[model samples]
Target: MRNLFCPKCSERIFFEQGRCARCSQRLAFDPLLLVTRRLEEVKPCSNRDLIGCNWSADEKSRYCCSCALTRTIPNLGSTKNRLLWSRVEEAKRRLVYDLCRLKLPLKSEANQLSFDILSDDPEEGPIMTGHSAGLITLNLAEADDLERETRRVAFREPYRTLLGHFRHEVGHFCWDLLVAETQLRGPFRLIFGNESQSYENALKAYHERTDRSYDRAAFISEYASSHPWEDWAETFAHFLHIVSVLDSVAGLPLSLESRALETLRDPYLESDFSALLASWTPLAYSLNELNRSLGLGDAYPFQLSSVAIGKLHFIHMAIQNGCGISACGWRAAPVPVG
Candidate 1:
């Protein structure tokens, strides 16, 4: 995302800020305009007071573009649940911001996109996180750092986060919008393998496997080994990850003069897949080293092999195809730069 300034005081503000720190003025983020304005200039989302939402609602709706996509939210009677819901919604806002900026379609004609966030029922047991048709379900407990980390370790995942979950699940929704019935399905199959395989059996076999066969060079994550659909989803999530990271670091001057991104192209605006990946490789390494300097784990823990990179390229093309955008001349294939 690009830097946003407050319309009132012109003070730099963050995406999640509801008030400008410099002037103590009320602020609201207009999704349609993608700008920060005085609160009185735009209608705040209905969720503003309820959840402290900082985004603005469109003229036709009471909720912000992000809040409008949610069909169900976890019970908020308890204060604990309300806090958890807030964190989840914040992450969702970031996801929607990226999607809108990328010009990706949100809902398929046949299936309107939506989200359901729920906690495990006392008698019904755990609520699994997955996508069906156009609906994405998230386990409410995922907002709890301990719970999410436990599951991540149990599943042997290299990385996992609230935004990651949102990106991964939405990959399923985009499949319906961009690939399932489109011409891209053929190429998708070639790269991701045949998604015609039984997802249920694949998931079962994946969890039941004893050998560490999945942490290979072929897939982004071991869970991606479950099915072709999963492979696409995982690759799609990584695609978002790279874009988000690159966007955050755009135009930053690295100490390593050779790796500085001061002249890097914007990831969301870049049409060439190879160029985006080329910029990301050095930036990701710098991010990991920065984290190490602070005594933290690698900021980006996964490595992309050549096969994984090819799958990512397919995603880049699929997104371009889905968005009805075209590129030519220098835009068609940008020369890679570190």
Candidate 2:
């Protein structure tokens, strides 16, 4: 995601901040523009006189941009719900911000979209990660690292994280875009398989068989090995994961020079995977080495497959088309990974 700063003071602001410490300015985030503007200084909200949200206090009206997208927030009476819901909002805002920056479409799940949210029986549930009727539901519990890690270990996945959840679910959303478009549907079918197949049975098959030969050439994760749509989601998530993480690493102190090299030529948009990977090689190496110094595992846990690269190519194309960025042309031919 692109970096965010407070417009008034240029203070680095967190996505969730309602006020800026550096400038003492109330702020509101514009979800459409993925930007935070000073409320007191610019576009002061008319509502500020009545409701007194910080944005209103600053004089900008119409719900600081991010809050406008909220169809419903859990009742704020419960402190626990308020805190957990805030975490959800922060992550969701970042996700939506990137979507906006990429000029991607996001309709409310209520607006006839394929996405939906379901409440597990309040008494008994995994407490996170639910899928129904094309809408993936997230339990607020996942925002807490301890709970997420516990579930991750219990699920026995090599990796699991909040951003992973977002990217994966978005893959399902984008599939709707491709399948509905006449130009892309046939190619999707040829690669990802008949998505109309029984999802439940496919999942059961994945869970029951331990010895099934894994198809690395076509998948980014083991769960992806279970189904074509999953393959797409896993790969899509990784594309976001890598790009965002690489940008974050670039912002760190250790590798400013390498960061310059990778982004200097627009590796994120370039169709040439070899050139992109060359830029990434040194960064990934330094990342792993840095992790080792701290007694941690590799910073990135997965390898890119030829199949995954093909999916990434399609994703990159979709993003470019979505954003109207024509700096680099896309390739229709699938890229093969050795």
lDDT of 2 by residue, 1-338 (tens): 34457887886554545777556778866554556787654554433333333332223535544345444445456566555665555555555555665566664333322322223355675444644334556666665678778978876778776656766776677666545445777787798787778888998898898785687787777788887778777887777666655654654334446545665566656655555655665566556534422223468755566688679767766866775643344466546659
Q: Give the lowest summed-lDDT range of ten residues in model 1.
A: 251-260
Residue range with the least summed lDDT across 10 consecutive positions in model 2: 110-119
* Alpha-carbon runs more than 4 Å astray in model 2: 41-77, 108-134, 211-213, 246-338
C-alpha lDDT values of all predictions = 0.81, 0.59
Give residue 150's lDDT in candidate 2 (0 to 100): 97
Give lDDT tens digits, candidate 1, residues 110-165.
88879999988999999999999989999999998889899889887878788889
> Which candidate's lDDT is highest?
1
Model 1's alpha-carbon lDDT is 0.81
Q: After superposition, how far is residue 315 of candidate 2 from its true place, in Å?
A: 50
Clashing pairs in model 1, backbone N/Cα/C closer than 3 A = none
